[model samples]
Target chain A: MIYVKELCKTFRVARRDGGMKNTLKSFFHREYTEIHALDHLNFTIGEGEMVGYIGPNGAGKSSTVKVLSGILVPDSGICTVGGRVPWKERTAHVAQIGVVFGQRSQLWWDVPVIDTFTLLRDIYSVPETIYRRNLDELTEMLGLSQLLRTPTRQLSLGQRMRCEIAASLIHDPKILFLDEPTIGLDAVSKIAVRDFIKARNRERGTTVILTTHDMQDIEALTERILLIGRGRILRDGSLDALKREYMTERHMTVLCAGLDADTLSLPAGMTLSESHPDRAVFSLDTTVLPVSDAIAAVSAQTDIYDLSVENPSLDTLITHLYKEYEVG
Target chain B: MKQFKKVPAHRLYGTFFSMHLRAAMEYKSSFLMSFFGMTLTSLASFFAIWLLFDRFHTVDGYTLSEVLLCYSVILMGFSVSEIFLRGFDTFAGQVQSGSFDRLLLRPRSLLFSVLVSRMEFARTGRFLQGILVTAYAVTHADIVWTPARAGAYLLMLLGCCVFFSSLLILQAGVCFFTIEGLEVMNIFSHGGKELGSYPLDIYGSRPLILFFTFLVPLACAQYYPFLYLTGRADCGLYALTPLWTLAFLLVCIGVWRIGVRKYQSTGS
Candidate 1:
């Protein structure tokens, strides 16, 4: 279980102007700006829960991860993992958690992947039997058998990412914190990672807090989403709830074979997004007009061959949330 | 069901050293070239001193072999510390590259992790050269080989290692305050070796001797111990002067601890 209440963190950034004159000026008297990276955030994640932490760049996502992982001490906050303060009991807290930074390589560059894993086994003081069991299962699950013998630098990005995930889980951490875990992998690699994460959460009951820009990763792996923007928790709900709350408009696309020439007239509050001789797309706001009425109105104007109705995608839903919250 | 036990620090360090040695040996050609290159460069310094002595039989009542003893001890201390403490020497770059963040994520001591992340095996070339110089000096230097004198010599070598390691740690601690490394710290590390190559008395400067004796404690490791070994100072306490270097190591570690706390708070 994890509980964070009113956590706040601020960073002081030095300001300097360009060119020799300003650079010399800064040498004498430098300006500084205070950035509130985490401003009074409150969230609690229950055991065996998989939550996606979503935010734009500079949105304090990584800052939150660092604080939870015991890498950074916040200025003022009450954050605890199963009653232990991460920053205060760093070594013990870190031993019970796993972290994967997608942009960084935790494995040694020149050494074989197995060497890094073995080193971590000792570093974490995992029992030999548990180490062997985890190694076997992870190797088979991640398809890292042959790749383990090769140096990490030689592996492709996809293969390296798999090893990175496996490396973090060698100690069988109870809580897994993934910062952009599926950042740059190909489709297959991404699916493999997501499936593994989902399976691990289901089977092992590992508490996963993932932060990623890839919406599909959130959709595939997490049922709950926590949207953060401008150092504040903007929204927290299920994927279905987000769709229902933001899906005031429904998009209907019609594939009509022969109806043409500026003929069809849509009902009030419905707008045509795209139009062609063979196909047309219309946006309907459900609050103003019913879905049944929109269907009848479209059928009255043109001979409808094929029609499909859908809500906005996760990408559009998030964009709408960002706009509603007025966060960049 | 079982009590958790962390790996002993010494055992973990041993594993780190073995892994580093293995990694270094992976690049056989580069390792050999640098190893030989260091020995050759260090040999050049010895010849420089030898050439100066060839022209003048004694500088400040110290013969050529006596100077070699001092030079070789400093060389051994410098190279030995470099072998183990090169991690701190390169700590600033690690912090910049965010590798220091990776180090902090682990459930181990940050200082130990940094110390183990790097080990300069190539510097063995300098260490070997120092050993050779010590062998040459021991046979030639005119001194009675008392057990206390031999102990003083070994202690002086250890002191030199600790003293240089302290300098490296101090520099690393400074990196926490300024992410950009201070290159000026090298003046003390490299300059101390150069200054310690000769008898401290030859400087003929009281402030210089005192500075080395108390601040960096380089002269305590070389000069006071050398006085006892050469029978110049009859005091038994001079043989124990290298103990001061241990005190210097303690101070360095204390500063390094403060830096670690600062890093956790600042998160830079």
Candidate 2:
């Protein structure tokens, strides 16, 4: 549904010293430094794919989203979504895509949330029947019935987020670009939003590209991730594949009915670190021994009450990805 | 898709405006007080001119009634422009506050969204005051109003409105590039009204041409058309000089388009 090739965006930034002399000099002649916000970025997302757009701060995540949604024109690139060049055919392209910038609101502050939706309905020229169907489904799924009557300024952050999601989808857009959609929400609201997104992907086949720092959101919603750094795509694969490849360590905790002992046998690359009377912890290097092999070896020697093994977290995986790429 | 159905853009604007009005009404005491306060300020502007005429009986041989004719049109046009186009005037704040991004993402034209999303209802009181002043001017000015003359006067009013609105649009378009929209834009918005309230001819040849051609097209919308209205100009087509106001509007829009293209490159 989306194809980006060698997409480059560069910004001309003014450069000046901090003190007074340079500030006055800047008024007469500005020295500009060119920063390439995006450099030869390449990615393609298929229709109905729920892709996680992962990156650190200033990693061009928002810039990529802006380009795809037809908000910004890249300096040089070929980006086509659904057979249309986004920036060139902005109105037509934007009609098929929905964007939610979690940092910003698209709703009118003083009006009831529903009124803003009504305005959006006219804006996209959504048919009456289609609008009602979408509104009904969203109101039910997102628990937006209560929010519709409240003016947006009066709504809580979570409530406003739910309404923003509804407002974005009023036209039944084919693709949804969510930029940190669950930011600042309580756990309940976060799960509610996550579940609603999953349901929308499943039921409506809406292709979702979600950019977020919250790893749990990635874990819960996306299987495929586009790991980006320094305006470049470092890895594009299934989340499981990433965890298996770069997830070098596994943590295991053992709870025993008896006293913790030093007699436990560990494989060559694994070591036991902490021990209490009835519990022990092991840090196993997955590169040297697979998690299953470590588990098998540990189970054989222990009179264990219970043992739990944990994979490297998505956060660690991402951190390593950034380090591995040395994205700057 | 749906045969390009007539979008309810205007009706939506009405709904948005009324909602904004309701919010304004929540501070009912302030809303009412500001409504009167605006009219009083516009009255002060007229009194400034009236007092000037008191000292000098006539300006460059133009009588008080003739001056009022020029003065009333300036007041009405400026008030109308400020009432409807205040968003553009204050768009630098919108850019700083990140609300301009909201306009960008909406499926409407950016210009229309900014124009329709907000209005100053308090300034509409200034418009009413301008009309009252114009009524006083129209009755006192001893001029024979032929049907064509009346039409020219109406056209001049509309042309002035268009001229000033175009200036605001140009100012907003430039804001998208600079991030800090120039405050110098206010000089044209306010100064045009102050200067256009008198005869442009009194301001010397260069000032007359500058006002006729650029900055605000005040001469096209007021001076030349008023001359024809007052029988000071013999050519009937002089009455049609108000149409030049439209060319000024077009040029402003063209400049705005260039600024918008620069904005696309900068993405601010």
Candidate 3:
């Protein structure tokens, strides 16, 4: 279990002008600005639960993950993971958790991937039997049999990401913190990673806290989504709940061959978003105007060649959510 | 299932060294060139010393063999410490590249992880030169062989390693505050190496001798221990002066812990 209350963190950033003269002057008399990276953030995560943490750039997602993983101590707050204060008992806290930073590799670049795994086994002090068992399981599950003997430098991005995930799980940590695990990965590798994560959670009851800008990773893996922006938790609920609350409308695009610009009119509660000579896109409130009625109106006014309706994509919904919370 | 026992620190260090060696071997030609380059550089210094001795039979009342003995001990100590502590030497790069975060996530001592992250076996080039100088100095220097004297020499070697390693730890610790690292620290690490290669009294500066003795403990590892070895000092206290290097080490470790705390709070 993880619990955090009123978590607050701030950073001091040095400021200087562009010119050499200003740079030299600031070196003598420096100026600094305080950035509030975390502001009274609060959350509770039960065991065996998968939560997707989403935010824009500079939204404190990484900061929150760092604090939770015992890498960074918060300025003011109470954060406890499995009944131990993370920063106060870092070794003990980190022993039960595994973290993977997609942008940074923990493996030695020139060494074979298996060499890193064995070294990590020793570092984590895994039992001989448990080590072998976990290694076999991770290798088989992640399809790492072929890549283990190869050096990390030689592996493709997707192959390397698979190995990275397997490496983090060598100790069989109870809580996994994944920061952008699917970044720069191909479609097949992305699904492989997601499926592996799901299996791990199901089999081991591992609580996972993942942060990513990729909404699909969140939609595919997490039922619960925590949206944070500008150092605050803007929304916290199930992904479905957020969608239901914020995205009641649907989008429809129509292709009409002989539509008169002056006579073309959308049905009630429909707004024309884009219009061209042969294509028109309309945003319709499904609660007010059904797709069938809107299509009938357009077809009656002109000869409709084609029409398609789709629920607002998660990207659009998230953009609307960000606007609602006044977060960029 | 069998119980899990933490790998002993020594064993872990051995594993780290082996891993480093394996990585170094990947580029066999580059490794050989680096090893040869370091050997040639140190050989040039030894030749300079030999030229000086050819002109003067002794330097500051210490015979040529005695000065070579002092220089070799300092060289071995610095090179051995540099071999194992290369990670700390390049700690600023680790901080900038964010590998330091990965180290923090591991469940081991930060110092231990940092010490083992990189090992420069090329430093063995200097080690070989130092060993050769020590062998020549031992054969030519007129010192009575005694078990007690051998023990003191071993202590001196250990002290030298600690002294140099403490300097590296201090350098790494400073990175927490100033991420770019202070080049001025070279004045101590490299400067200590250059100064320690000669007798402290040769400079004829009392304040310099005092600073090395009490502050950095260079005299403790080199001069005082040498005096006992050369029979110039009969006091066992002088022989044991090298142990004082531990006090300097402890101070460095204390500073490192404070720096770690600062890093944790700042989260850089």
Candidate 1 DockQ vs. native:
0.73
Candidate 1 lDDT, A148-168, residue by residue in tens: 999888999999999999999
Task: Write the number of the candidate with greater lDDT, choosing between 2 and 3.
Answer: 3
> How many collisions between residues are there in candidate 3?
0
How would you encode candidate 2's per-residue C-alpha lDDT over A1-328 as one tens digit per residue?
8999999999888999999998999999999998888999999999999999998898989889888987788999899998898878877777788989898898878778888888788888887888899999999999998889888899998899999998899988889999999999999999999999999999999999999999999999999999888888888999888877878788889887654455766778888888888888889997888878877776677677888988777788788888888874
TM-score of chain A of 3: 0.94
Local accuracy of candidate 2 as per-residue lDDT tens digits, B29-72: 88889999988887897888899999998988898999888888
Query: Which ranges of candidate 2 are over 4 A from the true structure?
Result: A255-266, A275-280, A290-307, B1-9, B204-211
Give Cα distance to truth, residue B5, candidate 1, Å. 3.2
Ranking by DockQ: 3, 1, 2
What clash pairs does model 3 have? none
Off by over 4 Å in 3: A274-279, A303-305, B1-3
Clashes (N, CA, C under 3 Å) per candidate = 0, 0, 0
Label model 2 with its docking quality class: medium
Candidate 1 lDDT (Cα, whole model)? 0.90
